[model samples]
Target chain A: MSAEVFEPYQVFVRRDALDAMEHVGTVMAASPEMAVLVARQNFLRRDAAVGLWVVADADMHSANTDPQFFAEELDKSYRRVDGYSDNARRWKRFKQQALQLQDIVRDLESKEG
Target chain B: MAQDDKAARGPSVAEGAALVDLLLQMADDDLVLGHRHSEWLGVAPDIEEDVAFSSIAQDEVGHAALYYELASQLGAGDADRLAFDRPVGERRSAAFVELENGDWARTAMRHFLYDAFEEVRLDACTRSGWQPLQRAATKVRREEFYHRLHSRTQLHHLAKAGGEAFARLEHALADLWPYVASLFDLGPHAAELRATGVLPADAAALRSAWEAVVVPELSELGFGVPACGGTDATSAAHRGAHHPALAELLTTMRAVLDVDAAAASW
Candidate 1:
């Protein structure tokens, strides 16, 4: 009898084409291929998946313990359109101004006529 | 019920009987083998493998249900009754599937060999003249792709590991080789099924295709290839005669039903 030590892998699966791959769980296997096979059974049995992935635990670069690594170190909100949370209200204000501008333009045209 | 089933398939009673026999062979093989596979559920060598065996076992039982559903449509009786109530003499599974799981190596070896053969059978089935059989075969073959992947991956890894793992797998190959040919037996209706296009015209070619897939892989793995060909009696026996282990397996499988047949709901 041979006792073998297995490598652990993080399992990820994509539920469908439109879905992003989510980390489902982990499996212990001797190889990447075997890990994917084990992951299929462990993670994808009940639901359908368009794709599966297994990254060796050893290969993963974890910043999991360093909360500061993921922390916002600088104000970079300009890069995100959604960062302007009041943009909806701003757009509403703009729409009202545009309507008033349209009214003024019509009055100017009436005078010009 | 029989009339609707017959109308759906459009086979005469004589033809229906032959078809039922064929369906039983496929169902019994999967059911028995799946039961054996389930034995490894919580006790496999590792955690991942336990889940793997559980999935494989579920797939096998599901495939068996698929075939049994076809058989029932052809008037073979309730699927549960056909699976659990049949006497050993009436079962059509080969002695190969009926054997007990000896070890992880043996189980993997058997899984590899059996899935290879099933690939050929399901391929032929995808072209079956019976539309339901063809459709069912297509679906089963899709799920089975993963089974083949898992089995081949395990066999290749174990064979490459060398030392005791390699030796155990090699021993398993030798021990299981003798019963391999019986898997190709298509029962008494082989000729009739062939004539009606239920089975492919070159029925014997199925075994050839299986060997074409299996032999080179085993050879590359440095395992000795056992001599080819089973005796005529060996091929003929699997249809009606079964290994004694099947009875024991069925006893365990049907324990609840045997105790209280009327109360059994599921």
Candidate 2:
């Protein structure tokens, strides 16, 4: 069995750490854990590092930046609790009225039986 | 890191030219030296060492960039033109930076010796109280920390690994010792810099401080500390008669830049 010889700046890090710092750093690491230290020196020199991660510079994939990917088809307000909120307690009042109707129906069914 | 009012003192137009000359000299030294070290990018003996040495080289270049920028504000020239377009004879970096890379062991020894002088020069600059220059030295110090670390590690490694074979390294050290000592050669600005409160220690005291660091380290490396034979020994490089290798370096570095000097864009 054989592994490729490591390059000069190449380093190994643990796997989990890769997911942690994906957007935050440029760590050309062989392992995820080692990437954290390298990333600290490269980007966080003047800042504090809460945690770090690395991925192989080669293995990681990125889309060929298409402008279409960024275009919005419709308002994304449905995802926002504030934007989509029903005012006048509409949804809550509806739920209460529905429950009351269901209780009346059950009472009527019991009388019929 | 803010500039002091004193640092803002302007010389007469003639004096401005003179100071600019001196500043350019100091800046160019770091630039040329950085280029030499950068050539070792792929070939450093160990993998970790390659990264470490490359970082030091980059730091040296960054220091040069800072100096050049300072000179530009003073109307010497932009940093790029000053760094690239000068002739060998007209150029003013020290001879220590001009020497070619020999072998890894010798390179480390030279670097070990170089760091001692750099740290002292920087310390002298730090206390200069010329706020802008002081800030520059402080920023450079942050990077020097790594340079010294890598140099010390490499020195220790070679000293132990090579044993008797380390003589080549010693010879390189001995040759560079006097030249390296010259880095602390405070120029005519000694009095001016002091009067401006730009330098706390005179050049001599700075050299002593440099020796204090270098002596113990050299001893550990199995190399004896070299002494300056005379005043001439300490001050020769400022005259700019550099190592022979400097000519070839200048030629190669300027080859592309010299072609389009008057062109509006690169």
Candidate 3:
């Protein structure tokens, strides 16, 4: 039979229920059923995996391979939690002021007593 | 008797010998077939299948090692010696496993037949009165789930493909069918093993169960099911006699081990 008889299927594995499925590898099989079997045999031999997914290579669509597809023209740090570093600093200052106010209240209470 | 009673008392002299025989048969089958499957490492039709077969082969060999360890506890010698040093005539593996890994069709068909039988055999073993054997059988059966899936998927694919693929599978079935019965041959200790509850059933009963499962599936796929008889004479040849193919296979399998008499490890 010609090599074309087999189609490539991408394999994905999830280690646990809470984990996202990650790409493992590709396996060549004649049909989707065979693909899943082959994917399990090839990829799940050693590791513990709670989930597996096999997608036909033909069925997958991807963005252009050009670096421009992933390039960020402007800083997008604000989109990430690390960009809110000032919030962490402000929270620490707020905690310190609250502690000082508590101390002041305690001192007034002691003087009154 | 309960499995707990058998475990407490251990085996009698007769039962111990019978257990050794059973373990040898199980180990030999896996060792020979594992070697055969490992031969497909780089030569399989596709890279994915190559990896799959390799993993299956490793599991089979690992199973053989487990059986051999159990046999050693029963006075069957060390695992390595039992695996590599035994003469061909002494091996208990059925002939089906010793047959060449012909074309992909034959390989797939043989795998389906052998794995199906093995699945049944191991399932039965899970209930063995011998606790160690039962535990080992249970552990190995987990890995066998994938093997059964692989062989079944490939066999169905070949059967349904039609044209050359189907024809090739048919031809392979005709060639392999006669040897299928020999896989169930449990050797001279069969009765003793069964009576002692070391084996749940005799070869005939296991073979019938195997056929019950295998025949209808093949028929549904439009393939002719080979008629079952008593033990296959051809496979019987390998039960106590040496087939040339087995000798050749053993030579290759032992080549590295034979190279050094004093080597500490493989």
How do the residues A26-63 of candidate 1 rate in per-residue lDDT, one tens digit apiece? 88888899989999888878888899999998899876
Candidate 3: where are CA atoms >4 Å away?
A1-3, A64-71, A75-83, A86-113, B1-5, B234-238, B264-266
Model 2: what TM-score? 0.71
- RMSD to the true structure for each prediction, in A, is 4.5, 9.5, 3.8
Per-prediction TM-score, please? 0.86, 0.71, 0.89
What is the DockQ score of candidate 3, to 2 decimals? 0.58
Q: Alpha-carbon error at B16 in model 2, in Å? A: 3.7
1 or 3, greater by TM-score: 3
Error of 2 at A31 (Å): 19
Candidate that scores best on TM-score = 3
The interface root-mean-square deviations, each candidate in sequence, come to 2.2, 6.6, 1.7
lDDT string, candidate 2, B124-232, tens digits:
7777554667788888887787677657765775576565547777777766766764465556566665665656777778767877887887787677666553634
User: Which residue pairs clash in candidate 3?
Assistant: none
Chain A of candidate 1 scores what in TM-score? Answer: 0.61
Which runs in model 2 stand beyond 4 Å of their true positions? A1-101, A105-113, B1-4, B8-18, B228-237, B262-266
The full ranking of all candidates by lDDT, starting with the best, is 1, 3, 2
Residue-level lDDT of model 2, residues A7-83, one tens digit each, is 11323223353434336534343234334434544554455445544556566577769989788889898787895
Reference-based lDDT, residue B174, model 1? 80
